[model samples]
Structure formats: structure tokens, C-alpha cells
Target: MLRRLALTAVVSLAVLSAAAPGAAAASGPLPLPSPLPLTLPLPLPQGEDDARTRLTVTVSEAGDPSAEGIFELECAPVGGDHPAAEPACDRLAELADEGTDPFAPVPRGAMCTQQFGGPATARITGTWRARHIDAVFSRADGCEISRWNNLRPVLPGVR
Candidate 1:
């Protein structure tokens, strides 16, 4: 009788051990603890593009108003009173495509030629690729002249 009872207990323990995982699953998964509050920025919609490129360009000579001019330029569709809107827009687009900031300034402490370009100065302001742009151009030095010339047609030729 004693042996039989011991055998029965052993068999029952084996059966229970085998069924333990299945029994827990059958009873359904345990509830997960609630997550903490999280703040996530919403993503922009698909097909959306950066802000339109619209700008006001002002060019002035130190002592010559006849050489001074102000023009509004709108790009992406290329409109406004700019004389070379299409070409200007093309140059800006090319710069952006190449991951270069067209309005970026010359690096500090870098060597530049001491050549003087002239007394022409220009200011460009407004938006490009959704960022505020307020850049100044001048032919004060070689680096400045190169910067001004690179953005051609955008800044009318000034000699």
C-alpha cells in the first residue's frame, strides 16, 4: 500500500510538471504593466517638401545708385522680378543638392588672397529650404569676392 501511494505521488508530480506550461498558457497571458507616458514628435506627412525659396536681394554700390538695385526672387517655380530668376534658382538648387550652404561664410583663420574686389555690397534675406536666411555679400577681399561671384545672377554683376 505504501509503495503504491509513493508511486502515485511520483506519477502525479510528473504529470503536473508536464502540464504546468500548457496550463499557464491555457489560462491566458499575464497582463503586461502599463507603459510610462512618453512624448514623441510627430513625423511630417509624406510628399511634403521644404519651405519655398523666396528672397529679397539688395545690391548697392558705395557711391553709385545707378549700380544699385533691389529685386524679389521666388524659386521652385521661379517667379518674381529677378532678372535671372531661373538661373539663380538653378544655382541655389545645385548647391543644396550638393549639401553645401550657399550662404555659408568663409572659415575663420583660413588663408585667403589679399586682393581687393571692389566697393560693391549686397544683402540677401528671406527663406530657403525652410530656414531663415540673412546673408551679406561684398567684394571687400578675395574670399568675399569669390563668395559673391559664386552666387552669380543671384547678385547682379558688379565691377
Candidate 2:
């Protein structure tokens, strides 16, 4: 009887050991935290897009770094220390909605003057609706002059 019990216990132990493990489910792949391991979407669209527009606006005489004046401009209900935030934001919004290139080179088809407004240069660096902006602005030509004139409100100190 003792021998039989020992054999039966051994058999039971073997069976239990041979049994497959219980299927403990797991929630696959823990969700990544917000702003976690992210990348900006590439290959931005042409014309105006939905990219957030932020700018580090700079202006100076062409080739003169010492004279450069810079400001910050933020739009979409603009909030920044920029002096002309309200009008600037409004104008910018209008241009964007109208599909105007706020930084376009002089139009080849349009007639423009040969007058030298100045050798001033402007650079706008920031993100504009998902697109990166490192645009250079100038008053070197008719188109550039037109571009500068159109953006004067946002630029400040320009008549």
C-alpha cells in the first residue's frame, strides 16, 4: 500500500509538471507616452498649410550683422512680446488664408521698379504649419522689395 501511494504521488507530480502553463494574457506593447519618441511629419505641402507658425524675425542692413534687430512673432491668436502682434497676426492670417506666399521671391511676370529701397535683409526662422522656415528676405530687387513692403507690419521700424 505504501509503495502504491508513492507511485501514484510520483505520477501525479509528473502529470502536473507536464501540463501546459496557464495562458496569462498580457496587454501587448505598452502605449508610448505623449511627446514620446516622436518625429515631425516630413514632405510638407505647397502653398499655405496647417503648420504652426512661429518666427524669430530678424532685420539688418545687408551684410551687416551688428545692426541686426530681432524680435519674436507668434500667431494664431498671437501672443508674444513683438510690438505689433495684433496687426501682424491679422495680416499674416489674411495672407495665409488667401494662399499668399509671405516669403515669395519677386514675381517674374509682374512689373516692378528698379529703385533701391535699401540693402536690408530679413530672416524668418521657425516652423510654419508643420514646415520648417529658414527664409531670407531682402530689398535687393523689385520682388524682394514688394515682399518686404507687404510684411512691414510684422517687421517694425520700416516706413
Candidate 3:
């Protein structure tokens, strides 16, 4: 069921793209998203700074001062300032393809408890795949902890 929904979404996007002005007619297979090069040059004046994945991370632990850092991730060649840039880019790309939102809030009715997994709290803010992302994650509950772990590569010192 989820697979079908994803396929439908992709197909709809293709159709909408084809309908755009000056768009070439649809060919055999719907054009797949071309992998972005490690360095993207948006010389068309999109009015943005460098076209790299730039991010900031802030983590706080109970009874400890907050730790903060930054990372720049590039996907194609998988080179950036991220410690695990290669794997991180691969994981991030996979999630993006699966339509996962890095900043998605916990699902409603999740089986979460008030138990504290740890005293870790983090805020991540950045540009990913041309979109701005600003999110906060905490280990105050099972669901939030799971979400924080999922983005471990991007958020160091959260454990």
C-alpha cells in the first residue's frame, strides 16, 4: 500500500512536470531525478548562497553544557565537512527518495512514554536538497529518541 502511494506520487509529479510550459513531451519512462553533483552551480541567479548542504547542530545534555557544531554535505562525490559524509549523504538521499522529512514531528498516538531515554536535546538547522530544514529533537521519549538516532550522522554528540 505504501509502495503504491509512493509510485502514484511520482507519477503525478511526472505528469505535472510534463504539463509545464516548454517541457518536452513525456518519453518512455518517467525521467528519474538525476543525482546532484557534489558541487552544484546554480548560476541562474536563484539569489541564494552556495548550493551546498549546510547545517548547524546544537546538543545539550543534562548537567552538561550544550555542544554545538556545523557540517556541509555534498552528495554526488559524497565529500563534505561531515565526519561520515559519504554514508551520511547516502542515507540522506535514500530517505529523501522515500519521501521522508527530516524535520517531521512525532506521529500522533505513538506508543511513547514519559521515560527519559537520556538528557540529550538537539536543534538542527540547515539547507538540504535545496530546502531549508529547522528541527528540534529530544530524548525525552521513545519516539523522539528514535527520530534523533535516525539522523545520527548529521547530529554528533547526541548520545
Q: lDDT winner among the candidates? A: 1
Best TM-score goes to which candidate?
1
lDDT of each: 0.78, 0.67, 0.65
> For candidate 3, lDDT tens digit of each residue in 42-81?
2323654334555655556633342344555666556666
Clashes of each: 0, 4, 0
Q: Tell me the spans in candidate 1 whose CA falls farther than 4 Å from its real position.
A: 1-51, 62-67
Tens digit per residue, CA lDDT, model 2, 76-97: 7587766787888788766666
C-alpha RMSD by candidate, in order: 21.0, 20.8, 17.3
Tell me the tens digit of each residue's lDDT in model 1 across 31-75: 764432222332224654333688999998835565478888898
* Candidate 2, position 72, lDDT: 81
Clashing pairs for model 2 are: 51-129, 51-130, 52-129, 106-143
What lDDT, from 0 to 1, does candidate 3 have?
A: 0.65
TM-score of each: 0.65, 0.57, 0.54
**Backbone clashes, candidate 3:** 0
Candidate 2 wrong stretches, greater than 4 Å: 1-51, 62-68, 107-112, 157-159
Higher-lDDT candidate among 1 and 3? 1
